[model samples]
Target: MNNRDQKGFNANDNSNFNIGKVVQNFASPETRNNSETKLLNAVKNEVALRLAQSLHRRVYVELDKTEDPSQVASPWSMDVKLGDSPSQECPEGTHIVTIFDKKEIGGRLLILGAPGSGKTTLLLQLAEELVQRAEANAKAPVPVLLNLSAWKTQYSDIRSWMVVDLKQKYGVRKDIAEDWIETERILPLLDGLDELMSQRQETCVQALNDFLPDWTGTPLVVCSRFEEYQVYESNLGLNGSVIVQPLTDEQIETYLCRAKCDWLWEAICPDRDIMNPETGLARSPLFLSMLVLASDKLPPELWRQDKSAKERRRILFEAYINARLSCPYRGGENYQVGSKKSDRRQSKRKPVRNPYPKDERTKRWLGWFAARSVEDAQTELFIEKLQPYFLKTRPQEFVYGLVYGLVLGLVLGLVLGLVYGLVVGLFVGLVGEKSSNTVETIKISWRSTPRNFYKGIQTYIVYGLVIGLVYGLVIGLVVGLVIGLVIGLVIGLVVGLVLGLIGEEIDTKISDNQGIYQSVTNSIICGIVFIPFGVLILTALHYFHEPMQLSEILAQGAVKGFLLGASAGGLLSAIEHSALRITLWLFGYAPWNYSKFLRYCTDRGFLQRVGGGYRFVHALLRDHFAEHYDPS
Candidate 1:
């Protein structure tokens, strides 16, 4: 016999076996390069798509910057020192991309700004430029924009977190993502530093400092609010930092004119006090955009009111919501009531109808979402991540658990039996009540057969033995041993072989809708697989004990199999989630169709879509809604 027969296979023995190296040996360097190129292109496209969605077709404001010592690591403590030249200071209107290229800065940059100061916008713009360069040159590092807020819950190690983000968000293969991070092929553009809890901010900075040492050659950009960042004792070990300055009076005038907000400028120009540089709402690009969007609906007298900057901002957000709701639908052509041609077309085509809730209802729902997000320290809101705590009241929680358990138990019990149903219902209800807040990310894919035929047979043999033992015992207790042993052996062997022939894997495209679709598909597969097993069991039992008609036995078995398989597979989970969502709707916490509402909010400029989830366009707006939230 060969060495393989004498000595069993050892995966760690590279001389004998190594799946990765074996594959690599077969793949040419050119093929590897082409694969990497495709991955980089995908990363670039994802970044570009995010930029377009977040920017919302708004004009790019030329933000000014100054080298701020207060928010940056001291020169003496720095790994790279800024030269003793006054020119090192970033002049007004210096392109952000240029700042990264400066030898003194060396691409490790910290961006600091106040709330609503356009820090994220600046980072996204920089990312766009870097992505373009990476796309043009294969040697350049691909830019990836990630929110640091996920670090608190997902991972402690920055490098591991980055690899997972690339895999989860950009659909990069795990092996490829790991290779890129290890080789420093991607520039990390991390945002939302201030979104972490106050206590964890210092720890996060320390983590960044630790991570930066290993990532010496790679470019890293981090963004945070100056106020929150300044309080942290630890500072990011970066080459240099720049603070975003507020818009000056001249810049404000220029932007207003470009936006065709002449009426707004005319109104603001008369009251110089209202435009105070320190307290003015117009100093921030975000508030300015809101002003421009809501200008027509906002009466001039509201701007003239003597109110604190905070109060004025609140008023602007309220006005903006009202304006968006009152305005005619901008999504498509409005079919007038008078035209018969339009009516006929609308009837036949079933033109898309507006899905937005009423103005007040929309605000309330948004407020609840924002409030929950703040409490959970979550920046990106995934619909699947909604937890039991979201129900708010004890009664609501009890109802949710009860309903979830009952639905699951009922479906499962119908196929199994009454004893199984009661036991399952009690167990599920107890588990549901004590369920943790974290949502486990599920991945699913379909395959007709196991990849390895021998391995499949080995797995099925074990499965068959266990199933046969249990089935035989149960059947023997109910009927004769001869019949029990024969039926159990046949049933177990058939079921095991059938199951072993099928396989599953994770779908790399991690999106909310994609997940739901995969879950449904898995349920169908489970139903189909179990149909034959159910028919066999029911038919044998009827023939031995009750002597039912063959047709009746077969029909009953098929129905039982499908229901049991589908429900146990994934349909039950879907049902539970939907039931909870409906309960939340009943409580007026959210709409029944959360995905649709969130997408609509994105279109209205209140939220931005990030991968499969959504986040408020700005933390400032989210806070505004949270502060004014009245659940009652």
Candidate 2:
């Protein structure tokens, strides 16, 4: 067959890949086109920024043909064209992009490497190039970097999961995300397959295999640790596989020299123990980079110590943490230590200060976070997603729930009454016991005509009636039954109508500061909407109920309405999350302001921001912290 046939498509051909054509026939073509352009630009910007953060200086690692592609790739000829082979061998130390372009591989590539061998870095490098290409050519597929570790068994289909990832990670609307997938405009670069549990790894491999048939012409790339991937019974259905090569001694020396780390190079070059094959510390780019960062703080004699690879790694990480913490801070003032105004005459640059919580406390908090993240099998940590499970002991959990419920109840009671407070408290306490495993972004938008307006009214009216009935029973025991029933019906109808008019739509998307702001705004709106209704109800009730003054009734009604409204909205959830966070802080597991702490860690090079969450700079670092975690 000709090269064009073998490769599945000509490099110059744009007919099959034109994204504009894909959405041209859809309704509101202009809107779709704009959304698509925005999505691609956002992806490019995010990928470029991530690449810059992970690798401060661009360092290309070499990739080579796997010794046995047949071992990891599907053997079934029907799944992939195994018979068709490349006319010439891919030379040693070939760039990943070049290998991806070859006819035989046809864009379906799998990358494998040993731990700390730069598998993720290589994948990001590939994504950077692909994103550039996509930006230049609309016909080219948009490259999206995702973590397979986040995949769950619930999503039996891989495409469905990708849709969710795009929506959550990139903030793409659900319909648009689905359209992008259906049109095959996305080039998925899935990383961290080995990060999944062993059993799930096999299942993910099978899922990828099943997903390939439907996505026959589209490109796909997956990364994993060679040792873990090789043991899996199932093989990925891909055109080809390549393993990331370890850094040669010469390459290591060149990198160190370029980094101006002559002392590190000198220490590593002469030491047989440090560069030994078993330890292979200098051979891995990640370790070498860590060594460079930690070199100044790391004592010279520590490198020559006789130690196992694991112990050596532990010591290296300790030094690395110290070095990062000790270094001058970089990035924007997202989490500044103090509010010091910058002088216009002093170059408008605030002087750098030491990071908060000190080095020892920072390490302990990170260790705790890493341990819990591993236990949950989570690669990304979201501030709002912190659960009761983060609390180590049962007593802690109980205290968190009780405090959370009690706080809400007391606030509501002070404003509304004892009955309202007790009911809200009981409800909130029950909800606190339930786990918050799902993370999502809720949006409240107004529609000209809500989809189920009548249904919503009916549902909310029922809720209002139930609450009103309880209030009526409580009031009736003290006051007359007629007065209680009349007041209850009016209050219930007004509250129900108000709620029914404002319909809320919850969308599952990733959010950070923006999400919190949105929730706060929602709470405020809910409080405002209920205040007037409350004032009118209380003013009318004063005639037949207790003989109260007009000003006193209005004051009491307004306060009660606002509190009840806020609590009924998202105020309860916000308070509950705070309770959980404070509980963790009391146990010294995390700081009070998690977002700031995480941002500080990102500034310190221990973590990197991914979408609305944070992930360790490398899985190896996460593993190190998890293994060495000391709760006490």
Candidate 3:
């Protein structure tokens, strides 16, 4: 064949190959649509399950004793008006879910209400309905409830925050959350716009506006307090808005009667004067719930007494808290909200914790915790994060720490001195002798600074106290204390001294501008080299003293020493870096356990458990505690 024909034939073959590759990778319109539908359905099911669980989790069976069993779970509803005539979608009073689901409403609605006026309850109800609809319709968007109190507008936009919220609250995979968000397959039922800082509220609203148009293809709803949202001169420009109406006196009377709380109904509205403004306190669902629970305990005439509304309300709430605390309550009920009659009422999960033991200690801890929550502007409080609030933050407190550390060390040294002192002293003597004779000075690194050495001492003391306490509890206090003290002192002194000696300035020739990773590697190597040798030396010295197999002694001692060294070394490295030290101090290794107390508060009505954390059942309750609590 001619050269030109051969070249043309080769080019043609390459072109055909490229086209075939494109065809293989490309998806047809139907295929893309089907794939999208499947992903949406999976998300819908996951969301439905979560919403149902959250909705039914808090069934006050005991509290419901006064009410009809059938109506226990029924949330109260009111007719809601949305916007003015022409552009108005939901002119007739409509529910939250209906406004969000109706195509004509375009799924963009704002719910504004007073504190504890049932905004959250309404949102939850909306979520429950959407969840059910999602199950029935494959094309429906999954509704996800998001708490906006944690949103930081300066750092992240609304869309980004939603992604994080999903992953955190629901344990949704980040990729899946992002995909769901990007595809607009998930509906965001945002709660607590008023929860954001007042100053940043405008910026948050603006960010919401910017984020909504292109990102979420489906409709979304936002909730805020009526007065808080009114602070701004302009509206949020949402499709429609509804103001949560105050409960009518008749409604309150009827509700109380239905709940079989005739006593409270008469107390608040004597002579069946339901419209009397004197019973204005019942307008809030929170206050009404409190009255329902506390009516039996409170004087029937307390509501009619000369006490001001504020004082009466305070007394009612205090009584309510006490009632919940005293009751033999279990956790919330967990049943599918929109299932068949037979299966709908099925209880799935038990209360998160057992009924709280009624006690003063629990109340005190909850009061302190509530105060901290208000200060931090955090509604959700995780148990692990509770340590920081209990931490002694005043700079003057370290003086106490130092004295405490010294006493601890001295006590530990005396106890452990019986066994480890001689061995450790002997090892130190040998090390000291070897160094004195050799030209090789003991090298120092950042991990061995005097400050860190002091810190290590403190850490060891705490560890010893914890171990000693545990042991003391398990065995007799005196014996357990002695044993734990010895173990803690031995580990702490051995590890602390080693780290302190090594933490000083090293010769320039040895450093080689070592980076953190390299330093860590070197520290690990040092631990691997020295720990076993030290352990072996100690074991040999004690071999005749303690009747044990030498090999077994060496093996166990070596393993323990190596672990101690590695832990000390890593801690030393963290201490050397300022940022890392602060981070560790603040988060990873803070020193208190308020878990038991937190659990107690959560089991009762004072707090609500949410994923790995606790939140005050309502913000108003938190404020009440914060203002009224005087722990001093």
Candidate 4:
């Protein structure tokens, strides 16, 4: 061994120069290649494992600082990747923050930013960490990976889905899943109302109103396209937010260099002048992976193969990863729940050459990959695939929703009517008494004139309002209690039975869909978005609960207090009715009724039968409940 032959480690060469020992370990070309391949595989494994770990760990979650709701949907981080030393010099206080510190005093993190701003990537990284934390705990090793995309449209009733689906599919007993998932307690995380609703003005503020109360026990992190979720950030009063910004050129270079492949560095380092060069776009994990693969094969000079860099890069990405997933609908089969009927997606795509011509049975494979491409022109109606409900029922969701809501509407009308009746009834009685000359009328006044009594023992306003309120409340409570209990029990029993038994079957026929969720969420967010405003409803039954017991009720009660009492139940019934109407409206959109309305004939005979037109239609009513529905 010559010391002159080794420039860096001559002493090590002198200690052992056994080239035979290093090279003669394998006898055959296959064995040697296998051994070399194993070494390469081990090296590759370490790099991927380390890089993936770093990608997750290096993610910063800055805590504290009040955020603008508008700022929330911006990149949750001004910069997602570790940037390079600025070419123009680093700005002070940039990339320095309390990101690693826990921001517990505030609400759950609401990661926001523009599309492609790295919010989802960063959150997935964070989720990886959370899942680890849960796994490390002595109990509950399996961490649930909730896809917000899937979650926004998952079984709306998660409890039933988990219990029923798990039992049927996984053979896991409902009891076990309930105890372990504590699903009801964690419903808040799965509540993606913000995502489900259209992200526009006042959306964030509205979403916050709906979301904050829904979350519990576990920490929550939401990722949304920046502009979309900014709607809620301000109203939520979140203590902290991080906006992800695009990586600078130098940052792009540093990442290129750190890829530690001479191939990658040379491939991406030279795009100094082009706007958003393919190399510069490599900040994204999706793009980053492409760079690694392209780097392995192409020279630095070859990366500039396309003249328009941005266009070239688009092609580059498409060439590698297919398309960026814009919706859960676009994602693969795993995202979907199994349909009872087999997916007819086969008839969907115009089958050309099978990507994997070797496998004749592509459809049968659950997660099979077939590279064949199916192209559709932009103007085709087949591009839109509707959920099963719209396909199965011609359009009955609205009808069901409307009928259910109308059925429940009687309750709302009764409540508001009682309030109207009680006040009106009392005012009439007070006025009657104050103006009366009868000795009997003197004690109990039915109608009274205004005598602004300030302990002169009763102003007409006070007396009338008080008496009417009291009588209204007493009668309303008795009526509501009797009616509500009977109605609720009967309706609930019938609905519950159907829902519990045939519900699994019927539920599939009705999907709340996005609009329904949004409507309910909107009403929730707006506070009055869910209120019923129509008035001048029938008030006949509200005057008294069968007038015979009315005197007995008023005789013992304080009119004012009792009216208020009656009003509470009425208000609840009203609120419930309003909520039901909103849901029904969602099911049976009014716009869809035009076709049926148009079918009506305007003939003289038809008019005669229908009571001469508009008045007849208004007066006549018919229920169209299904056989499953119990009128009681």
Candidate 5:
């Protein structure tokens, strides 16, 4: 090759032309793209699997083909529309995904259906399809399924909320989720718009409209009940919409026959004038599933009996709960056991014995929990949310809490006090047995350091125990007084462990003040710090159990934490030398003289001297004394 042709790595040149460098430069973007694509697919598959497992587990009874509207009969498809008004019908019969494909405008789809119309199932099925498509086409947007019921009225824009929801619900990294959302690389499949407050539905629709820019072409899907969505007159600006068709009588009969539920078929058959309001519910997939489940126990006469739709649904719910509770636990099927962990499938465990042994008792608790859920407008039940409900049911919640607190304080205090007293007695006996030649310093050492350190720990333990016991007792009494003992014990143990390990010492140091003032200052500091710490600890605990609204947490946490902090401060102040002397002198707050009190406590092994000052042998005694002094 000529020199001129070789310029800038000429085409024919092999020598001095770096193949490795060229390859590296050429392959960098391709390799990165491939890696990122694989990561995205993994995330999609993981999310899809988790969502699918949860759905299947929740709907444990197999939904046979006979029960499906599409398979057994013509799948009920809704009219396609742009916005709220009906548009020209281009397709004769189609499912949700086909509408997305054939739509002229953007792929924003709103699904309208009745309560048991299988809208959720359709959305999940569509999401699965999109997820599969995304795997093949790297540029295809990933499908993210979200429960609209869990979407609180926080975000003004749906896009912003989608980012957060993906991170929280699907375990997607915040950064990756944000990148996908901002880049329009995700198709949000939102289910349960009907779960929100009626007033909030229009607001959500408006938020969706506001979220999409004029130039943006990102697709989104929403599911809502027909009645609920119709309440809002405003159109949800979408390219396509459809309603899930209700199950027909033939479909219901076919399912019943296939499941060997002959009695149930007779109850809702055409011969019984099944079109009437009483027997009309047979058309709903949910009610049919319930019937199929309860057919063994529920007599056909029960279904034929005249009753309101609401009454029938209540009966069905009761029967459903009864059947599930009575059945043997199969891993994750037990509702009462295990937390809703981040990884749903991995977290499943063997069934736990329910506290309520009888099915009736379990059903009653379930009813109570359901009532509480309705009151709170919660779609999912958590044990933590029921804590407040338990208190509300008890007319004497406060009285019970106070009485329990006092009882626990006294019992725990007496036991701890006696144990420390015995130790003090032994130490005194030992010291008396020693020779007089022994230095006073060794005697002080024996009395002060070990004793005070031991007492500090005791105080923390007692306070935590007392607090935990009182809280748990109050909750347990409201739930079931019989279970209060177990609840209190567990709570007390957790609190004690947490407090004893993390408890801070009252710093007996103050500028130019060596004893009482220093201790008083330390108490104040401890109280202040405990406020946030208490909130953090309690919030974490509650989040894992029965989750509550943030507002409720803050209000309740602040009040309780403040009272706790003040109690601790006053209790800590009692141990300081000058403070004790002044309080006793000024108001006769304590019965004994300051010096005599010190000697009495020291002799009892309840306190130990540190330089010119004294501290309790255990923080428990100190806290008890403080609590007694400041009863309020």
Candidate 6:
């Protein structure tokens, strides 16, 4: 086939090449390459819209078979309105002409929607109906629905994919004939084709043409992002489309009343909270399902929680994740409105993975898959995403950071304090020395004079302290205490922290950590070294005209510093203690663990990790928070 014939999708050619008995044998590089190029060019637009329109006809239902014990839904008679949310068939517009009939849809249908559109829920509901109908029929054949992402080849023939996927979905021991299955017109729905990562549009289209054909006309539905379809649809040559639109509150209300699920929204009730008289389900089908599931699973009496209107909406949304986890929680409930209890659930073989590997030549070939994953460990999950987070892990290194920072500040503070103290002290001493008649001790001994008594005492104290400095004890013990505490308290204060960071910056220029450490030492060392300044100040005061004794002034300083230092230490100590306690309590896990996670945060949270302690506590204490920590 030349480019012109290849221009349109060719399902026959691809079928001949891929036809083989062993599933493993058919999985080859050549076939994969050929298939991807064809699929990339396969028909788009109307194909997606048409499918979406078809699938939209089914009634929405619960994903889980068992009730999520934590959820609180509305009363049985209460008709919870879907309020503004999209429904199956009618998105935002009035009814239009039918493009296809039930006969065309048969037991299978597909609908492709944009990310925000309600494709998945609509598809699931349809799948449920098809499964039910097939089960009810004695002559019914197997009908399977699979996500296209599970497929390995980007350009894969849909028919071959069907046989293989059905084998996996049904645990078929023997391979089924592709022609035989097609002749009977059995259709298996596949969703999310835009999610496939192959760059070769031509190959993907060819794969589809060879795989899906008009002869059988089995309904195949797929959703594509609008942008993706525009770029890749030339080769497929297909049309008929439906676009999902935003729904009004009235629409949501109408759907919800019709849905008659375990949820309802109105002004208020004992079971459901008073939703914004205006707020309704709208925008997407996914969101509608989230609200229904959360409302149904959570206890009805509790659905009207203390959350802000926005917060309640967010809480309502957390059910999607519950829906996602429904796979593991299957029990004995039927989500389909008309489903019979006697109709047993089918468990398929292990799920299949259809990987579409990218080759290096195309611009998006090799790494495109990574780009599309959209969410992962580092990916931030918002309320919309339905992923939970544990907050306790955040402050894990708090103590290590705070203490290491403080110790360094102490050494630097000491050095700076010495220089500033010595310089200031000496200047005061020199100024006082200039004022004094002689530098030694400012006192004039007078015989029989009351004033002389004070002078004599002042001189004695100054002289005594000088001698103490020269000897073993510098300044009297009182002098030392006075100066030390004052210096210690100030050094430990917030000013020290600012200075330390500044010191670090200067260190960057000079690469001098010793200088940084020296400054920290000085902040604390200032208290010790500056004690002398305190004594000198007392001595200088004595030289002045109305001087007090040097000893009295020194005593005052020592007392203040000691008291201040003790208070400061206690504060810093408390900070450290609180940090550790909170870090353990809130983040990942610690003494308390996250015991309340499944219980406290159940429907209201998308908690991935433990609620971090402080943030978690804040959330708990927030006005709407209903529970308190027991710590029992």
The numbered model that scores best in lDDT is 2
Sort every candidate by lDDT, greatest first: 2, 1, 3, 5, 6, 4
Candidate 4's C-alpha lDDT? 0.30
Model 1 Cα lDDT, one tens digit per residue, 1-632: 11112111111222222334323433433223644666556555555545554422322211111212122111110111232222234555566788777655667777887777777777877887887777665566767777777666446778777777665456565666787787777788999889887777777777777787677566689999878876666566665566776777777776666565666788887665557776677777777767777776776556665766667777788887787666544442232221335434433553245677477788889998998888877776777667676676787877777777777677767766767986787578646553322212222213223446557756986798688878987878878776687667766776566556544322333355555555567677777777887788777777676687888788888988787567545676576676677778778888887877887776566776655667787888898888886473
Model 5 TM-score is: 0.49
Please give, for residues 509-575, the per-residue lDDT of candidate 3 as tens digits. Answer: 1111123334455457556755664465346445423456767666656655654454345423322
lDDT (Cα atoms) of all candidates against the true structure: 0.64, 0.67, 0.53, 0.30, 0.47, 0.34
TM-score of 1: 0.75
Model 2: lDDT of residue 367: 90
Query: Each prediction's TM-score against the native?
Result: 0.75, 0.77, 0.58, 0.33, 0.49, 0.32
Best by TM-score: 2
Sorted by TM-score (best first), the order is 2, 1, 3, 5, 4, 6
Q: By the lDDT metric, which is better: model 3 or model 4?
A: 3
Better of 4 and 5 by TM-score: 5
Which digits, one per residue and each the tens of the lDDT, describe model 4 over residues 1-632? 11111121111222112223213321213322222233223323322322222222111111101222211121222522111112122242333123312333121444554433455445544444544433343221222323232222234444444455333212233445564345221212221223343533244344433444423333344445555543333423232345555555555554444444445555555655332532345544434434443443333333564556455554453332221111112222121111212123312334333122221121111001010000110000110111112212423434433433443344333444555645544443223221101000011111222341222233333444444454445544657655434433332332222222210110110111222232233323222211111110011223423432444333322232222222222332333333333432354322122212211211100001110111011000000011111111
Ten-residue stretch with the least lDDT total in model 5: 435-444
Whichever of 3 and 6 has more lDDT, that candidate is: 3
Quote the positional error of residue 396 for candidate 3 in Å: 9.1
| Candidate 2 RMSD to the correct structure | 8.2
Off by over 4 Å in 3: 1-60, 63-83, 86-95, 135-140, 171-177, 270-279, 299-306, 328-358, 387-596, 630-632
Q: lDDT value for candidate 2?
A: 0.67
